[model samples]
Target: DHFVVLFPILSRNRFSHILKGLAMSGRQITVMLSYPSDEVGNHLMDLDAMYKANLNPHTDVLSRQEFRKLFGYTFKHPFTGLDYIDLYMDLAVDNNIEVVLANDPLAALSYSKDVLVATIHDRKHLKNLLLNNGGNTIIGLDELATKQGKSGGYNPEFGLLGSNLAGNNRLKLFPRDAEQFCYAVQKKLFEKTGKTVEVLVYGDGAFKDPVGKIWELADPVVAPGFTAGLMGTPNEIKMKYIADNELVGLSQEEAQRQLKQKISQKGTNLLGQNASLGTTPRQLTDLLGTLCDLMSGSGDKGTPIIHIQGYFDNYASE
Candidate 1:
């Protein structure tokens, strides 16, 4: 069996070095390069072509202009970028490179099995796979937490307090559906205070969870824009603005005051016994905000993937 390794275009030099080392050790290597359609426009084009070819029939095919109009006004193409599809297609034709693997899904539409190896990265493609094979229930973070708490019949109130506040106050059984459970909590909070309150939702690895098992909530059941769902453990609050005018006229001090007031009002709505049992502390909102900033920031420092190098070593030693 041939060993395979996936690397980004940025790591071409490193990939070459590794290949040479393997070759010197009297081992054979087959290189399969993948190029991501980093730009939304190229991604849309591939989707459109795939649909036109009857490979994907559910999605509506749109022109480049239509795609821009529907999504946004801006289309950015990196200056130092190369179209890997074109480059590889020509290479395959000239050199007769068999078993070529591609990152773009549209490559399969043009190249034959002898020339192209299809690799799917799109969410819709994955969902379709699950759907075709007797679909599995994708549970969210809230639901998963509720399931974990069900056996013990944990109180929802302790969810609000600090981690140290764990108690055997089995007031009521937690709902199986996390979103429903959270909504029930929200409703109780509103009833107690007679006011509308925003609820912030945050969790990690919602997308990375196994398809057949419980998944994390991507959006809040009640408030979509108002809620924040983030990956990783919560630590520190980050500020997020809904609109430019939300802080345009206000001084920095005034903005901070408004933000805190908003958070407090939301937290107050989730203050009742039932509400507190199901919800977390107000500080979680800030942690979600920080997650968002890290995700949207430029990747000049490094890749998005966080590599905890010594984590396994420390865990094993402990």
Candidate 2:
């Protein structure tokens, strides 16, 4: 029987025990580390350290192609164009490799074979799993902004600012603000067209803040407010429409009159219905840092894969 288990992190001792247990149970264990050939050597060195400490050397580390061949099929991932981890799971079943340890989330999904699948979510409370005893914290963008104050620090603006900061300070920092910008652009488009539009944001190497440049380049007559102005125009219309039709269930004319009165009394640019979506940039860098710690075996108790014994006992009993 083959099993697929997803784990956030585990201690070295615990991980060693799992490997020993799997081997003791008369199962051939294969540990697959998702890394390129150039990088696999370093990963193997870390695994070697674990093996040396535990004194269990039964597990085999297979390269991507070698592992794929065990399944007797060549399949590429539809989206990533990489070898799908599902193929390896199927291969494990066919080749009778009882336990296969991997770190890819794609491996966590359901597969065609009857292999037992289990996941351990012990690190749900953790922002990022600490590997092996490494002292590193993975924080989200809001936390990052809070830690380093700047206007719109948690938004797409941060990426632009980060580029300038890195250059000015001569610090090596890579910021991935594409995801956040995509959310903002999508939100703006949705407000304008009332339709959910998918946007693919490509990174332009010039990371100097885009806000001022956008304003300078924009047609003053058409897009006076730049990005925020463009977004606000449709937002105002949407809010007025909602106020007229839904808020008090008033007639269109009366709702417009009341909305105008409210705006005149309070202020223009009032908050809209969908203004609180709060899509900020997540802490992807933090996650990367955590992964680096885990892979280097410097993380706190950092075991990349957790082995759960008797994982299929309930299913087998039933």
Candidate 3:
């Protein structure tokens, strides 16, 4: 079996040394972006519709323009925050990139360009990129198993449940449970009171426990029971709840004052909770550091590095 380790991080103190060693090992690096498969499929269909409709004049030939327009516009989709995974795939094929690095889920979404257009020659970059993180998640089977044993019964207030996966990490929250219902009620209360509704879901050995911490920062609570059903709530209700609770004590005369304050405070809103992770950021940071160490020692067959000038200059100064 090929032993592969993954490291996900912004940058480390020894990043230069690691990069140099990686390059020496003949590993080719590419940046990766990932997206939900369904989202990508929808985008592709939209591209087809736009191309067939000849929606834009900037395109070359009517047919070719259609493809180009679709290709060009693909980057603008906020779902992935990128226009061209295909371009990256093309570049990877031409340059022979081995490993594709991605810093976050957003970056992963950007690299999805290769899912469709990459050719046989594009295989190396795709292989190395996919291999790096074991396809975006490392399932801790041991954790999932432990969680199942610990969850003797569902915690109604926390929406706790066991997952189908093999590890203790698989415990999940039920989207429609009382915890979610109560949180939704709390959000509405915030709208009425104009104070932040702190919904805390505190239960031991359960993932939903983190919802309380999020509630601590929220204006109103809107915790749902299950992960899959989270999108069902209307965005307006969510905002009203958070605004009412988080904004706290805003009379009509002070409405504008509250709005300005919220704007400055980065009042959490419709978009913010979408990427919520139950684990604290520090936990993730440590995991990434470990993964990086594991990946650094992994082998690379033979690929040349074209060092960027700034990177070369930094090393020269060192």
C-alpha TM-scores of all predictions: 0.25, 0.23, 0.18
Error of 1 at 71 (Å): 26
Please give, for residues 1-318, the per-residue lDDT of candidate 2 as tens digits. Answer: 333333211222212223333334444334433321111111222334444445232344444454444433343332234433443334342354333334442332322111111112122232233222231332221222223355333322221112222232232222345456657877997999897654332211111124312111000011111122213121122343446445686776877676665434443434533421232322332222233333433246543432223321221132
lDDT of 3 by residue, 1-318 (tens): 111212211111112222223234443444332211111121222545545655442322222233455444544433334433343334333343333322232233233422211111123454455546445432211112233345443433222121112232232332325456646766786799985443322211112213212111110122222222223322222335445666667676576565544434542343455222232323222232223323332137222211112311211132
- Candidate 2: stretches off by over 4 Å: 1-66, 69-73, 77-101, 104-241, 244-249, 260-318
RMSD (Cα, Å) of candidate 3?
21.3
Candidate 3 regions with alpha-carbon error over 4 angstroms: 1-47, 50-70, 73-75, 78-318
Cα miss at 19, model 1 (Å)? 4.8
Off by over 4 Å in 1: 6-26, 32-78, 81-99, 102-318
Q: Candidate 2 at 231: error in angstroms?
A: 15
Q: What's the TM for model 3?
A: 0.18
Q: Decide which is better by TM-score, 1 or 3.
A: 1
Each model's Cα RMSD: 19.2, 22.4, 21.3
Q: Which 10 consecutive positions of candidate 1 have the poorest summed lDDT?
A: 157-166
